[model samples]
Target: MVFSKQVESPITTEFFIDEPTRAKIEYQNGKALMARGPQALHEHVVFHMEKALGRALPQMEVRFKDVSISADITVKDEMNLML
Candidate 1:
């Protein structure tokens, strides 16, 4: 599900400054669109991906879901080289 709205202000700075904690908002062509949360299938896939990565690379850290503000999955080592 995607929810979109038009705002009077520029979406760059102001959108993030007042963005809701749970909101995944995107800006496109002056429109503010809220992204839908992951579905069950997507979550399951991510979970398995995380597990597989962890097993494959025992020395690295495998993170899934909200690893960063814009990242869904991340693999990081002690040096943080592959981020």
Candidate 2:
């Protein structure tokens, strides 16, 4: 996936999905976050993680707040919250 940011402002973040299992986050701080080859559950929890932070991050820099998981996608991935 590709990401670009503008040269101004309070900071806007956008996410994209490709290959179904890969996720990307583009932040206004000239940062691009990518998490590739995640299981279905990893995708779900990461979505929620972004949401949870979005709600409380009016004054924080979200680029540093981004989180990611491992590339391994096994049953253990689900057991570890990839589900």
Candidate 3:
């Protein structure tokens, strides 16, 4: 969840995520504010990589049977975010 008081009333936004979400939230002088959702950042990274490479990159996923697990693992070569 995120909160902002830049308006007359406080604004709240909620998100459901499967991965650890990255956020940039700032409050200036306890009034003005700024924030970005993790989804937005993910799209930005995907867009830039696609544009720079001139092609869409392949994506992968894996699953396990009879067991449940949650972990931060590396998918691609991006060291910034681990799945």
Candidate 4:
């Protein structure tokens, strides 16, 4: 899973990963957490990424959070671009 946010100033990127297919995100805490499932790893990764964004840029635009799979996830394939 992947997530992103557009911020002002010099643009940049960040990364994160949750352990044991689980993670806690400070932003949108409930929205992503609720997505838990068999593909928990994917969800956790996205959650981790979202939290990393805050660490990378405290003033970042967090509303842009996105999620997708590294492999071809037929279900969310269309959302890859959003990631």
Against the true structure, whose lDDT is highest? 4
Question: lDDT by residue for model 2 over 10-76, one digit each (tens)?
Answer: 6654443433444444444422333333354454455556567764223345464567766965455
Backbone clashes under 3 angstroms, per model: 0, 3, 0, 0
- Per-residue lDDT over 1-83 for candidate 1, one digit per residue giving the tens place of the 0 to 100 score: 33222223332311112223334534473233323444533333433464577632122335588565565787777896754
lDDT for each residue of candidate 3 in 24-51, tens digit (9 for 90 to 100): 3344632323236555555446555756
TM per candidate comes to: 0.21, 0.22, 0.39, 0.22
- The best candidate by TM-score is 3
Query: Candidate 3 vs candidate 4: which has greater TM-score?
Result: 3
Model 4 pairs whose backbones collide? none
Q: Model 4 — which ten-residue stretch has the worst lDDT?
A: 13-22
Q: Per-model C-alpha lDDT, please?
A: 0.39, 0.44, 0.47, 0.48
| CA deviation > 4 Å runs, candidate 1 | 1-38, 55-83
User: lDDT, candidate 4, residue 70?
Assistant: 81
TM value for model 1:
0.21
Ranking by lDDT: 4, 3, 2, 1
